[model samples]
Target chain A: MTQPQSRIRRSFGDLSERALAFWLLVPAALLLGLVALYPVGRLLYTSLFRRRLTDETGNSPVFVGFQNFVQAFSDERFWTALWNTLLIVLVTVPGALVVGLLLALLANLPFRVKWPIRLGLLLPWALPLVFAGLIFRWFFDSQYGVINDVIVRLGGERLLWVTTPELLFWAICLSIIWKSSSFVALILLAGLQVIPKELYESAAVDGANRWQSFWRITLPLLIPAILVAAIFRTITAFQTFDIPFAMQNGGSSFETLAMYVRTMSIENLNFGYGSALAVLMFLISFVVTLVYLRYVRGADD
Target chain B: MKKLFWLLVAVLLASTALAQQTRLRVFVGGQQRPDVMRKIFDLYQSRNPGVRVDVEVGGATSDQQQQYLTTVLASRDPSIDVILIDVIRPAQYLASRWADTIDKYLPAASRQELLRRYLPAYSQANVINGQLVALPAFADAMFLYYRADLLEKYGFKPPTTWDEAIQQAQTILQREGNPNLNGIGFIGAPAEGTVCTFLLPIWAAGGDVTNAQGQFSLTVEQAQRALQFWVGLMDQKVSPPNMAEKPQDTIRSEMQAGRWVFGTLFAYAWNRFQNDADSQVKGKIGVVPLPAFAGGRQASCLGGWQWTVSDFSRNKAQAHRLVRFLSSPEVSKILAIEASNLPVFPALYRDADILKVNPWFGQALPVVQAARARPQHPRYAEISEAIRVTTNQVLARQKTPEQGAREIVTRLQAIYGGR
Candidate 1:
């Protein structure tokens, strides 16, 4: 009985030690809750209400369970916006990855001009997003646009780059590619640097050509980097609004999910619907993250 | 070296402190020319010493509002004292009590001066939820700008009705040939621009998108007729080849070059048109009211910004002072003369200086008088979105006008039902 009592006392002693460590971490834990968790929780709570702010004096936030969600789902514009967003992701994600990989490969080349080429390629990403958006808007302007001017001179009809929904979507994708490809390239370039060159030298000795070496060796090794780049690009593209919003003013076929949420929350002042739409966007982004975690993170493993 | 560094730091700190005293941040949109804003600020500061307004330009109004709201909601202290709101949004802000009411700062007589001097619609735009929330900073109304030279050369008078307009435009275009001229053009791209500039013509054709009660009053046949007419203009070879792709800015540029016979545009372009620095038809352009639809009245959309005080602002008195000063009759006249901003006062319509400097202003008075505001319901933004989608569907020929109209009605009913 004395031995059993001693053992119980020892167990209580260990529990207290761990409890002290956890208590020591409480400040940082509380900080995280304040900065991140609290806002998200608040957003979720706000989504449950109908928020109407009139003249700063008459803000009435009332509970309207699921009504906002119902409206968002039933609206065809919401569906069209969703469709447009998906189309953009499908077009932009693969295009960005391929271009980034190509840029990385060129940068990894032994040529003397590689450094200049790499810097030049990455210059677009270094520029501010808004400035880049502005430049692109000017580039795609139909009447005085350099793009249209060139097309017309080359014996092609002028294409409305910012106005038509179909053309507007592609124009937006072009801006995204210009701004984001360099970022992807930089990431992949880092990944390529870490890779041992001896593997490629050995493959060459075995009579494998450059294409074969790339597919067999570089691609497999680049997978981890490629996955990381895609996760970043996809997330950014999903929330993509600046380029489209700036270029087309979110009126043309270029209204992304982010733009829709903005119009609802800010323009329409329907915070409930805006919140609901934002939550749905969050869920989509969350699913995308999970997919990346499972497929890309799993592949890395 | 240490002493020198200290001296440098002292100088920097002194300068920054001095700068802070005069610095005032003013936020504007992406489309607003930064250089023009700088000039305006310089002019404002030259008159008002020791006060410098810093411009914080953001994206379009929607994006700017997102940034503005997030800032206001996040800051414990009200950082933004004066806000420039779209004319449509003052009501929402006034309703939310986000803006301070202008009652105390400007008494009844001064306020009445504004109502009497500016156009009724312009004055009314700022009266959101019965509180005067903002002063009109700039006014933009749709005006029919025709090729005066073309009409005079071809012996064709300005058409009074939509059919007459189309017939006259066709005659000019057929003779002018494809490369030299297109009959008419517009902003038909699927954006706010499309809805703003293009929808007026449709509404003027005696069609309604939605009623004030938020019911969709657009008939399937009427909706189809409107779409068909716009597309038919292209098919009948009246408008440019890529009618659906052009923005209003492009259409304006083409019209300025005398490449297009006529176009409808915002009145702000008058300054550019009269300057002749870049225009081919600088002296040959004329402004008039948009053609009326058969058995229907001409409609023009009202566009501009209104000023509102933040409810969260601690300096309500100062904010009120700013609004009143900005809207004062004398200041309104100065802005109209110097900045070419339209006077918001109904009585300012007869201002001699306004007529002397801006002949276009006199021509636009009738258009502004007949102008109607967009559906003033809280769901106007949503209504705009619905209109954009349906218009695109029609333009793309993906959905018939009847089908698009049905879709719009169903969608609007859902929005109303949810509310």
Candidate 2:
């Protein structure tokens, strides 16, 4: 045992820096595998069968290779949830990005009482998702909600915000943007700090107006930050669950992919189909994230 | 030597007795719920000194509790020995093997006597595969609550049929235009309420969602006919157009706010209607059976909880002992008085205290007796979802009754046997 232990120590001492770096990373690499690969593996395994939790005759667990996936292709709810996810990401990403950039620019200005403005901009991001959902839910409630009260006071009809299909989806998008825009703003603010004051001065000396400098100088340099923020915000938006769940109970109007997975796995107890859906969700998120990463890398190159 | 041997034997026996004493964790919904159930569990503990029973009040509502239970049971964790069972959950729990049949723990002769003594609807809800998986903890069923003042002023007696209710509602809506009031309040939200509301008419019409053969016994016509009647209420302006989205709680709040001329709500809301400080319709309401189709039976969907032993429990004996004690007639009476719950035992209705608390119980007894249960399929959650989806569609005018029926049938078929 001593001989083997000494040999192990010698091998570690002999390891090259690159190999040693990898060797040192083994524990973290294992942790990453556990955190990421285990659930995906379990999901993949469950997806390979009809693993309904209920032992009722028709619902009995049985091997049904790729059948759940095949069924998903034709499921209207699955398609609806998928469409809603894409629509929400489409709405929220740009919404947050534009708002984030504006806030960042405002914050970067030579201004008075800067910390309060920065804190106010960052406050929504600091709130938990559930709390944000509750606040926004109250904001849009058709009855006694603040938004409806203002509308009614202004001689406008109270919209059925959480009930109407299009209105509810937009409400979800609005909630997502409200909750995450600050996070993006913070990222852009950090990016803004790195830009030298001389670039703007040089642009000004070249007869460039503020708008022209903003467009030509700040815009190009800030693209990297915007891209980074957009990639992360897009990924987060893909897994939107808590806000919509809090807004309404079980209407399929605003069901996202994560919502569908939860409804199937948790509510319906159809773990097999739920797992298949989850695997599909993981794949989609992975692919989207990779695509965004590749685009960012390409831009850098 | 003999005295020493006897002392050793006695000591060993004492230690064995101590080791055999079992402690159990019983999970229930809401903090108030455990307080109500504590008397029974306390009684259980007193009788069995060897057992210690701890009541855990978990989720705020039955829905939340069910979700927690589902997660825990899905892992087959033994943390919960005795669990609260929603009326609609026995089939699901039994099918999943999350629950164990408690028949073995019950005395055969006493079990038969108890079964015969309880209300058939209440007892039957706990039976799956002819095995006693659970026992009803209380009695509850849905009811049609109306604004007495509005109905009297409008010169309408309580509607005995769905058609009459709608006609009366339409007249009320057209004439009143009170802006503070609608014709009717309904539970049309896509949660369990919608399914329960839809089940009322379906069961009244002598239809069921599925049969015991694991078959889709619900015909297309049964669903379409029910949906046509229900959706007509919405289309004719007798029911709120937003009924498809308002949950039962919303409708209840509306009812208590004096916002609806007629409302359908759960029986538990009877107390709140009369006594809640927020109630705007206090002393202005009357309870009645759910209106059915003309020439059809009046029906309400049964709603109650059961006490189920977890399959993973090592202390099932202690759990069942507690269940047996809590559901006993005397204890059930105490439960009714303590918790303001309707009793599962038929005899408890005759109790003066119970009748006093819920004065509407006398008028609603027939409805309770006739209350219909949902399908006992193992995929009940999915089946219930189908009901909610289809009914919401019909109410929303997104699908015609016929199309809604077709969609529901198709979805259910896919659930049971699909590609």
Candidate 3:
């Protein structure tokens, strides 16, 4: 009995030492909670309440029980923004991924075009997004746009790229492609480098051609990296605002969810409704991340 | 050895403290021209020898506002001591108690001087709930710009009434033969610029988005007439079809290109039209007040920025001094000449030296005096956006004017519910 009691004492002491390490981490953990999670928590808290401009100034935060969210869901503008946001994501994510992959493939290839092309592919991402937006806007301008000017000079009709609602999406997509496809390429190139060359060598020994090897080996191996890149790209595309906002100035047809959140919050001063919309966006992106982790990461792992 | 090490450590710590003492971190929006901003800040630093003000300008207006306001609201010891604010937002800041009311610090004589010297409406706009929330930092207002040579060449006089203006535009369109040589270029974009520039014409024609009772002011017939007139400009091809997307600057540039004969523009446009190296029609452009709508009073827009102190500023006294100094008549005149901003102080507009520097002041000063402010509601930004969106929709042919106007009224009611 005494031997067992002594063993318990020693185990308790060991446990205390482990506990001391956790205690040391408490400050850092609390700091993360305060700095990172606190605003998110406040956003979530505000999302559930119904408040107005008056409520924001000195009125005690009241519990309205999902009314703000309900209003957000019912608001046609919210749905319109969601639709536009989804459309932007749908157009941009796959477009960026495919183009990025193609560029990365060309960049990864051993050719006379390799270094210059690689540098060029990386240039868009290197340049500031605002500059990229302005450049694309200038290119797509109806009258002064170099693109339109060239077209008109070549005896073609001028196209109002940012004005036409139908064209606004494509113009924004063009800029998104210009600014972000390079980021996608950079991410994929990093992934492509991590891929084992020996796998391709083995496939070559098995008599697989370049295309077959790429399809069968390189792509499969790169899936995890591709998934990571896709998830980030998707989140960014859904929150697409800067390019569209810069191009069209919070346009009627091109109001993305991110832009609407700002429009409602700052411009409209409906912080509660805006907060609710933002919370929904957060929940959506978080769920998307979780799903990606479960499906993509789990499959890879 | 221990004594020597302690002495070195103390010396290093002392230098670090000194470095930290003189640093002042500031934040501003990226909308300002970066080169000009750098020069301005460089001047600020040179003038204040001991203070090094570090500025971070964001790319977008909304992003800058959000980041700056969030920092000010949440910081235990306010991180940013200076902020550049949009004019429409001072009401919100004042109401939320995020901005300091500078009236207490400003001398009564200076405040009275501001009132007596500036356009009455613009001066009143700088006041919030009877407290001087901000001083007018820069002034902007729409002015009626007509082609001086064209009107004279065609033996036509500038119209003083809405009907006369429309007839003149129609007559010009009929006679010019060139589709590009329209009578007017209206900023029809579904943006804030559209609301500021185009709404002036509609409101001057006796149309309003909201009435004095703060209720929705657009009747279906009145809204239809406004839309008809706006689209009529396009039907006559006076405004380009692409105008639904064109920004204010684009129209200004086009006008400078002599493609359009007349357009409404901000007062600062005089600088761009006459002085821009790229301008072709320099010294040929003319400024006047927008013509009155049939039986309606003429109204231009009152748009400008105001200076305010941050509620959490550590140096409120210094900030107040800066505000007073900047708003002084002398500073206003200097800025008017240098920055090409419309002087908000009336005295500067009347000053002989200012008029000498800005010859167009003779025409533009009256426009500023006659300018109409958007609504007095703290939610004017919200109201403005709804008007912009709905107006854009109509101009884009997506919705009828009636539908768009009604929708806006509904949104306005929703926002201002039970107020």
Candidate 4:
């Protein structure tokens, strides 16, 4: 008994700070494993099996390894969804960033209506996705839509903003920009507020123009904020679902990767294929984010 | 005074806990006739004070509600005592054997009454493999709402075939001479509405997604023909170009805006088409059965909701009672009139009160009698997506009729293994 007690005391004495931290973090780590790691592991494992929600053969999964991936690769919908997702990311990220930067710059200025403008900026992000989608849908309505009415009043043709696939794609982009740019603007504005006024005063003392100062001082200092905003916007645009889903109702041409996962899983009830698609989506986003971070790190160096 | 207040609070909390034990949770779509549902639930509560029903209204759309129900049933969850099932959901439920059978839980008298009074299609459709999986709750069928004044002005009878429909539409478009006015409108948006509208003529032509012979009888060719015929309306400029992406509501609004000579809509549209204050065609509209392909049988796609007790439910008895109460003749009549539901009970068709409220249902009878239910496959959702995609493709002019039909065949075969 004395030997065991002495061993316990030695073990306690052997606890390094890092070891103590590791022991203390064990619960949280296990919790993360249970919540995040488990679902991901299960999703990966489930993807290897033929598991139908309404599997008449009892809920036992029949293993069909890699067939789901093969099926997905062969499927036309998969390709369409991938391309659409890429298109949305490519288009919306830049569109939102530019607009957000402009808005942030305007918001940084000493305008009398700054508060009202800020409130208006916050409104899109504050409104729920469905409500914002509905508003945009109405505004772009082919008949009696405010936008259409404006166009018609200007003696232009009343376009099928929500009907035609091409137009619907643009409309979805418009709504996404409408909803997300506000968030980006808010982020950039915080970054803009932190920039020292003395740098701008010094630049002014040195006879640098406003545009030159903005390009030379504001943008360089704002790079970290821009990266953060871009990364956030990029991830969101990659997983484009609600706006397109609400605005265009998943038009055949505009099925995003997220929508494809949903169509396969929820709508088709083919959980195995859906899981494979979801895993693939996660992988794509992971790789893109890694590449992005590498590029950012390289640029920094 | 503080001690007395605490004692009163304790009593209230104790009673509330007891009340919670007996509460039955129900899954109801909030979007569908909620006021009428509330009224009926209120009536039930007033009658049965001991039991409490907690209606969890959810999902803006029936599809979303179906998804919620699917998730609940996937885990064999017992929390939802009674679920309001879309007409197509029973097959999925029955495949999993998740929902309790009404025949087992319902009282003998109420079960017998339901059997005797329920409409044949509904009664038959609610059963799976000879087991009564659910009870008929309400009825819905597609109705063709036509401009009576325009048809009369154009000296045409309501077109009884797709061929005739196109011709009539073109003539009306030319004669109406209003650029804004189109020949026809339909819920052609690639949704469940599109699936229902697109299938109406094909079904009337004795075509189906699958036939009674346990074979994939619906050829891509037939589906293609249906698609071609639908697309012909757009091609001929008879139906407005905008109609291709319009939902039933948009179609109805367009009709009310007096821009169409004919429109296809649900049973709920009858009242609004005839009576709504904003309606442009009120009192000037006539109803007809959806015209078939030439020399084919008449058809209207069966659409409605069903009520089933969840198998895992702890309060199955209360759920049965609620189902029985909802299906009773009096409540059903109220449902039919106030909610504008097409009653699934055969006896209520001739009810004076129902007729007084829905005069157009007189025309709705023959159509209801001939309604065609979508194939009740366990994989019905997949079958429906296939239909929606194929129809949308054809309507959008992305594929030829033959191509769309072939695509449908390919899609179905991919899912069902083409036995």
Candidate 5:
């Protein structure tokens, strides 16, 4: 055992620093390839075929090239699902950001007992997405829902929060904002904590007002954290499934891309088409991430 | 030395017992009452001591169960020996070879006898391409549930035609000036139940989504007229304005709360309406065959579960025995009396024990006999999605009846492509 251990140490010592670094990275690189790259590569490969799991003939997957992608382009349902997903991201990301910023500011206030406020901020984020969806689904029920009850008490006409497509869309967005804003706030709060207390003290000495300090100091210093939060939230919003599914079981008029993928791949057993749709979704997310990274770099400069 | 010897003997005996036992896993949906099924399994085990049966309960809803079973079967997993499937799934399962044909287990004569025992509609659903693919575990059909007291108070009989039903509902609503009370309730939500909602009117109009040749051949005019009838109900305020969002459970609860004079629901709701502690409509409920379109025939959408032996099961012979045992008339009667599951055997409907426990089942037999299965194509799921989604859109006022009808035809035509 001693001889083998000495030999291994000598071999590692023999390598140059750069070479040693590369050698050390081999295991991690292999793991990344297995966990991340393999599934994506398989998705791409499957997207190029015509494969139905239920085909009785037991025929092997036939090469269809880009036909699945072509079909998705012309498929009206596919376009509707894509539009729904984009609308969700566009609306919910900004909605969560603004709400999250306010929450972060409030929580950042000098309270003697900070843990309780932080814990309160965490409660919504910690709740399961499906649970949040179900709670809100009841809240929006047109007949016996609490929202309608309140409105009726206030002398307002009852609105159909779930039956109408526009209202259902807003209801889902509201739920998403409620669940995700806490996560954004927690991130933003961390960013706030890292800012030097002396900077704020010095700003106060210069006679800057509170609002001015928030705008000129806190907001500017919080960009990196905000960008990080936006990146996570935007990607998650693109993959919105549980909330919409629990609310309406992916109703046709309000279906997101992820839900459509599930309908095709799992429900219809049409793997090829579903994979193509999934690949398209991945490309959109990838491009958005690239743009955000570019913006982050620009902001740093 | 004697104690050590006995210990060795016990270990040897345990190994032999373990080796002798053959475990069979049966997958049933949550709605099937797996707890009750476990009792039946116990009986089977006692009869066949060498076989140890295990129960795996699946999702509550048909859609969820289908997704779970599809994933399991597609992988050709042998873990599930016997599968309980929705009534509409035999064709798809058989076509995919996920289910083993029953002919191998039962001879033609015995299979014919077995099929004859079941209701005709069930036999029609289970037998595909001249082969028996499954056995019905129970029977179900959509029924028009009404408030008996309310209908009597208004001096109206159960409406037999869609037109009469609407007219009676309107008059009742106008007379009973309760703002909270609605005329009728039915599922218009985008759920598996909506498929039946979409098909019910067209079927009542003597039209079908598929022709006898199993091709897409929906009559566009019939579909349009059927859809317009539903939209008219909303426009006339015979149904609630938010009908499009109500699912089967929601409709059931609303009806049970005495919010509606009439509702259309499945056979299972009878149990809840009568027995659930919170039910307000108890002792005042009446069920009838769903109303027909004028000049057309009455039709109910067939809904039930069936037992199938998994093709990948290692012990197919034992699985066949278990399925046959579970689907027999004797066991069917037990399920009917114990769980309120409608028996697949027509004779069981008249059985004194079952009728005593569920008197409404007497009315159910005729409705069940007249019930029709949804299209039996392998792509039935997609077909159902198209119809239900379009129906939801029409009910939600996103599309005109004509647009919805044409879209269904177009979508089905595309799906059937060159067939």
Candidate 6:
């Protein structure tokens, strides 16, 4: 056993550092390629062709080059969906961050039983996206919805929360904020815990008020965590599907980019156009990620 | 220890026996009650002791089920041997080669006989490209539901035309003096039901969506007129202001709670209105053919489910047998009586037993006979989305009727032109 073990060690030692590193990375690189790179590569390839899954002729996909991309650019629904996705990201990311920060601060308060508040913060995060959407859909329902009921009870005229597009947009944003803020709060809470309570103590000794200390110390230190949360929220917001889809069932006026992809690929069986749309969505997300990474690097500097 | 050893040996023997038996999975949508389906499968299992039929229930709505099935079928998943699909999906399924043709399973005589036995609309939907793709599991069509007690109280007969219906609704709303009550309700949301809603008025006005050559034939004027009527309903308060948000279930629930004087819904609503515990419209609901345009005949949108064996199924022969058995006339009668699903066979529609359980089905037969299927195209889903989305815009007052009509024409022209 000892001789075999030493022989194995000697063989491994024969490998140079670079070769060892390459060998070490082979499994992870292959895994990443299989899980991530292959689907995206296939999507890129599919985007360049005209393929209909339901075509009765059994014809192979015809090479269409950039025609699908051109069609997407000219499609009015595509633009509307892109705008809706962007609007959702713009409205919901900051909304979640602000609300999440408040919740995180409250949960981090020196309370006797932190578990209840922590669990309260976790409940919305743990709820399924589709379930959250359905719950909010009911909440904003025009007739028997809780929102309308409360408004009527308060002597305010009942507003059509869902039927009206603008109202539905706001309602969706609010629901997304409610659903995602807990996750943001959890992340920020971790940052808060690592915050070194001694800094706040020193600030107090330096005659700093609670708000002053929070603004000067907590806010500055929390920036990295906030940026991380924002990046995640922004990416997810771009792929917003479940909430809006559950609320409106892919109504044209409120359709998101992801919903449009589903309508094209799955509903219409037009994989070519759907893939083009997906690639466009991916490019937008990639650019946004790059921007966020740059901002994170600048903050680190 | 010896007793334990004997028990283990017995368990192993039973496991081997079970493994030898064939297991088939049948996927049905939520609309088809799985419990009722399970009972039917149990009957099949009793006769074929070597086989086990397991029921898998899918999504609640047609669109949801379509999406789920599309993903599964596209991947050629063989786990599900049989599937229950919407009436509109047979063409798509056949074109995609997801559904196995029944021609090989049935002799020419039996196939023709089976086709002749089912309702014409369903027969037309199931047979595509001279191939029998599916068998009708049940029949459904849109019906105009009203409060029988209220119409009688007001000494009025059911209106047979749109104008008359609108006039009656106005008078009833004014007289009822109930703020909670609305005149009429139909699906105006951008859902699968909205496609039927959009086509109803056009079909009633004698406008065909597709020509005999299977080309897109809807005229801009026809579309405009249909939109105008629906928009007029919302503008004149015949329908609720938020009608654009109401799906079929919402409309059903509202009508069941006695909030709407008139509702456009499918055959299934009759069973719910009369039997559901929360139903306030029990014993007071009246079913009628949907109203037509003044110069045209009445038309209902044909709706139903069909059973098809998956082409990728490992147990193709057994799956085909199960489908045929499930769609047999005897099973149809049982479904009609027990679940209130309309029978696909015309003879069962007139069956004494079915009539005894579902009296309204007698009235529904004429409507079912006259009902029209939506445009039959492999890309019908795209066509449906274009029309429903445009109609929704008109109903929501986001677009004028002319704009909506023009949009529909443009979108449909592109879809047809692309092909």
Q: Top TM-score: which candidate number?
A: 5
Q: If ranked by lDDT, best first, what sequence of candidates would result? A: 6, 5, 2, 4, 3, 1
Best candidate (score: DockQ): 6
lDDT of 4 at B412: 84
The per-candidate count of clashes, in order, stands at 31, 1, 2, 1, 0, 0
CAPRI level of candidate 5: medium
Report lDDT per candidate. Answer: 0.73, 0.82, 0.73, 0.81, 0.89, 0.90
User: DockQ, per-model, please?
Assistant: 0.30, 0.47, 0.29, 0.40, 0.58, 0.62
Winner of 4 and 5 under TM-score = 5
lDDT of 3 by residue, B1-419 (tens): 99999999999998886776455555556644344445555666688765666776754544346544644553434656556666666676666666778877758887786567656775677687778787776677787788888788778788888667777777776877775676677767766666665466557667666677656665656655666677767766656766676667667888888887788777767778888898988888888787787777888887776667778877676666656655566656766776677777766776787788687776777777777777666666677677777777677776777787677667777667743
lDDT score at residue B350, model 2, on the 0-100 scale = 78
User: How accurate locally is residue A184 in candidate 5, as Cα lDDT from 0 to 100?
Assistant: 98
Which rank order by TM-score, best down to worst?
5, 6, 2, 4, 3, 1
| Runs of candidate 3 exceeding 4 Å displacement | A1-35, A50-60, A147-156, A183-228, A296-301, B1-87, B103-118, B137-139, B162-183, B213-216, B345-349
Please state the CAPRI-style docking class of candidate 3: acceptable
lDDT of 2 by residue, B89-130 (tens): 988888888888988876788778878978899778888878
3 or 4, which is superior by lDDT? 4
**lDDT for B338 (candidate 2):** 66
Greater-DockQ candidate between 2 and 4: 2
Please list the residue runs of candidate 1 whose C-alpha ends up more than 4 Å from where it truly belongs after superposition: A1-34, A54-58, A64-87, A128-179, A244-247, A252-255, A290-301, B1-77, B104-118, B135-140, B178-180, B191-193, B196-199, B202-218, B396-398, B413-418
Better of 5 and 6 by lDDT: 6
Q: After aligning candidate 4 to the native by TM-score, how far in Å is the CA of B287 from where it should be?
A: 1.8
Per-residue lDDT of candidate 3, residues A1-301 (tens digit): 6999898677666667778679779999999999979999988887766555533632345677788888887888889999988988898899999989998887888686567987898788888766777778778877678988888889999887776678768888878976888888888888899888899899999999999998998899888778888888987787787788777655655687888898776655566778999988888888887877787757757
Error of 4 at B288 (Å): 2.4
- In candidate 4 the C-alpha lDDT for residue B342 amounts to 88
Off by over 4 Å in 2: A1-26, A56-61, A292-301, B1-21, B107-109, B152-156, B167-177, B211-215, B416-419
What's the candidate order when arranged by decreasing DockQ? 6, 5, 2, 4, 1, 3
Please provide, for model 5 over B1-419, each residue's C-alpha lDDT reduced to its tens digit, 9 standing for 90 to 100: 99999999999999999899999999999988898899999999999999999999998888888888888887899999999999989988877789998899777898888788889988989998998999999988899999899889989999999788889899999999998789878889888888888888888777888778876678789789878888889898899778778878888988888888899899888888999999999999999999988888999989988999999999999899889998898789878987899899888888898889898888889889889888887777888888888888898787899999998888888778722
- Output the TM-score of candidate 6: 0.93
lDDT of 5 by residue, A1-301 (tens): 6999898789898898999899999999999999989999999999999887657422478888999999999998899999999999999999999999999999999999999989999999999999998999889988889999999999999888876788999999999999999999999999999999998899999999999998999999998999899999998999999898888754666899999999999888888888999999999989988988888788789
